[model samples]
Target: MNIIQNPDSTSLKRTIEQGTADQRIAVLDIINEVRKNGDAAIKAYTEKLDRVSLRSFLVTEEEVEQAYKEINEELLTIIQEAACNIRDFHSRQKRESWMTTQENGTILGQKYTPLDAVGLYVPGGLAAYPSSVLMNVIPAQVAGVKRIVIASPPQENGYLPAGVLVAARELGIREIYKMGGAQAIAGLAYGTETIEKVDKITGPGNIYVALAKREVFGHVSIDMIAGPSEIVVLADDTAKAAEVAADLLSQAEHDERASSVLVTTSLSLAREVKKEVYKQLEPLPKSVIARSSIESYGAIYVTDTLDHAIDIVNELAPEHLEIMTEDPMSLLGRIRHAGAIFLGRYSSEPIGDYFAGPNHVLPTNGTARFSSPLNVDDFMKKSSIISYSQQAMLENGRKVAAFARLEGLEAHARAVELRLEDL
Candidate 1:
């Protein structure tokens, strides 16, 4: 990792940003072909992208039941516990369709209602993220969404991972489809003869899957246009360099494009953390990917003051941010941007990914500034509820009419005027 003493802010943004126009165009091209050809396009894309040839694209109830018997029971327990925690936390986020009455008998308020059905795409990439399944599905369940469907590619033996299936079963989500990538997203968004059309789609995938979601947004709602994984640690002299480096490499191992950066105020602390990152990176399973990520996208930038460190973090708007300074709370008010902020050494990023109560499906590639982590809100829709008595309409009718006419909407004005004409 290169040590830049007060590096340029623009350089940081250009380095870590994801989701460019070219990527968007490529994804759109794929989505268009899939939209045109339907199942045939899905078959071709699956074979081309995942290198798997499938005879069928659906996982039957019999198969799902058999998977439970095949896998060990111990792992199932862990998935169950995690599911309960996720479910409990999200259940708290449940909202109700509401209405309120004015003193003059005018009824008005916004109504919160869950989507009828939703689809989730769990990527069976380098590793199967079963935790992701729970993170995405339980929120929909909490939001009282009626039907929750999930789609993922099968392994070489044409079977889904036990952990994933187990997670789904725990959530009572029996709708599992044996399809993935852009095709899986297409299946969810447009609906196949066998698969049901969903009101929205959520979960994570590769660039192609993200692009497919971007294209299908208007047809059906989606989580976000996710990008590559990233982590930024804002550590000072008090931080344990070893733990910081370990957390950095954890995200790095995801892929070469993955990024891990550390900004601190101490030069000695910077050197120690750099050495610690290498020491930790040496004996790792995915060292090849991690090493390249740290060298190419990772860095140890030294800032003169804590404010400067906060500035860099805000500009980056990293997906995962860890603050390990002496007074981590001091910087809390200062941090204006980031997907999920990890405070102090104890609040590591992995906790949020697995055991922690918060949702781990965060916005990436500088989207933290605008977007938020997936929650019950993603699965629900809102409708404004309005009801006014005759007297109430007469009281506010003139204001409503003039306001409508100011926008050159005579019909809108007349609608209100007609309602109050008898008054």
Candidate 2:
């Protein structure tokens, strides 16, 4: 990892992947085909891209049962327990519709409605993410979303990963589909004869999937255009080098584009962590990928003070921020921009990824400055409720009309005036 005394903004910025023109064109073609042909286009794309032909996209009960047999009982139990943890955590985020009646007989409030249906795009086959399944689905389910669908690309053997199937089954989600890429996204967004259109699409995917989500933004809701994984550790002299190095590597192994950075006040700690990072990298199975990530995007920034380090972390706005200073909680109020904040050495990044019960789907690539993690709110919609009483309307209707006409919206002013005239 590169060790620098003070890095500038140019050193921190990473280019967000927006896909190439050819990829965008390809995604558009796929989406149009799905719109024109529906199920046939999905089958064609599945056969061409996934190298598997299927008459049906739905995963049957028999396949799900077989998936259970393939997974060991212990793993199933762990998945079940993890699901409970996630459910318990997200249940705290559930909201109910609320209204407030004013003294003037006006009712003003907000109504929260869970989306009718949602499509979860799980990476398929060898790249299956069972944790993602738990993170994305449990929140939507908690939000009272009625129909939750799962879409995954099938392996060459014409089956989704057993772990993914088991995770979905644990959550009682049976509407699993064996499709992937932009085609699956299109099928979920536009609807096919076999697959129903979802109100929102959530989960991670490749460049094509990201591009497909961009194309279908107006047609349906999407989570966000997620970038590569990132981790920023704000530590001090009191922090251990080995633990810091290990936490950095946890995100590096995700992809070559992933970033692992350390901001510390102690120069000695930075030097020690740089050495420990390479030492730990030698035996990692994904060393090649991790090494590429570490060498290209990883760095250790040594600041003059802990406050300076905090400033750098806020500027970076990382996806995952771990505070390893002596007084981690004291600095929480200073941190304004982290998708997730893990305190203390024991609260590692992976704990939130799997068992710690927070949604792992977070904004990446500095988006934490303005975005947030995937939660129950992402699967729900909000409606503004306004019931104006005759007295209230008589009081404020002329003000409303003048305000509307001030904006040159004559119809808006007349609508309120007509209502007032009727009263």
User: TM-scores of all models?
Assistant: 0.94, 0.96
Q: Residue-wise lDDT of candidate 1 within 160-260, one digit each (tens)?
A: 88778877887788888878877788788887667778989999888778778878999999999888888999988999888988999989998788889
Clash pairs (backbone) in predicted model 1? none
Give the C-alpha miss distance for residue 139 in model 2, angstroms: 0.6
Residue 60 of model 1 has an lDDT of: 73
Top TM-score model = 2
Clashing pairs in 2: none
lDDT of 2 by residue, 1-423 (tens): 778887766677453767889999999999999999999999999999988999898999999999999999899899999999999999999899999999999999999999999999997655768998999999999999999999999999998889999999989999999999999999999999988899999998878888999899999999998778999999999999999999999999998989999999999999999999999999999999999999989989988877778889999999999999998999999999999999998999999999989899999878899999999999888999999899999999999999999999999999999988887
Which ranges of candidate 1 are over 4 A from the true structure? 13-29
TM-score of 1: 0.94
Q: What would you estimate as the lDDT of candidate 2?
A: 0.92
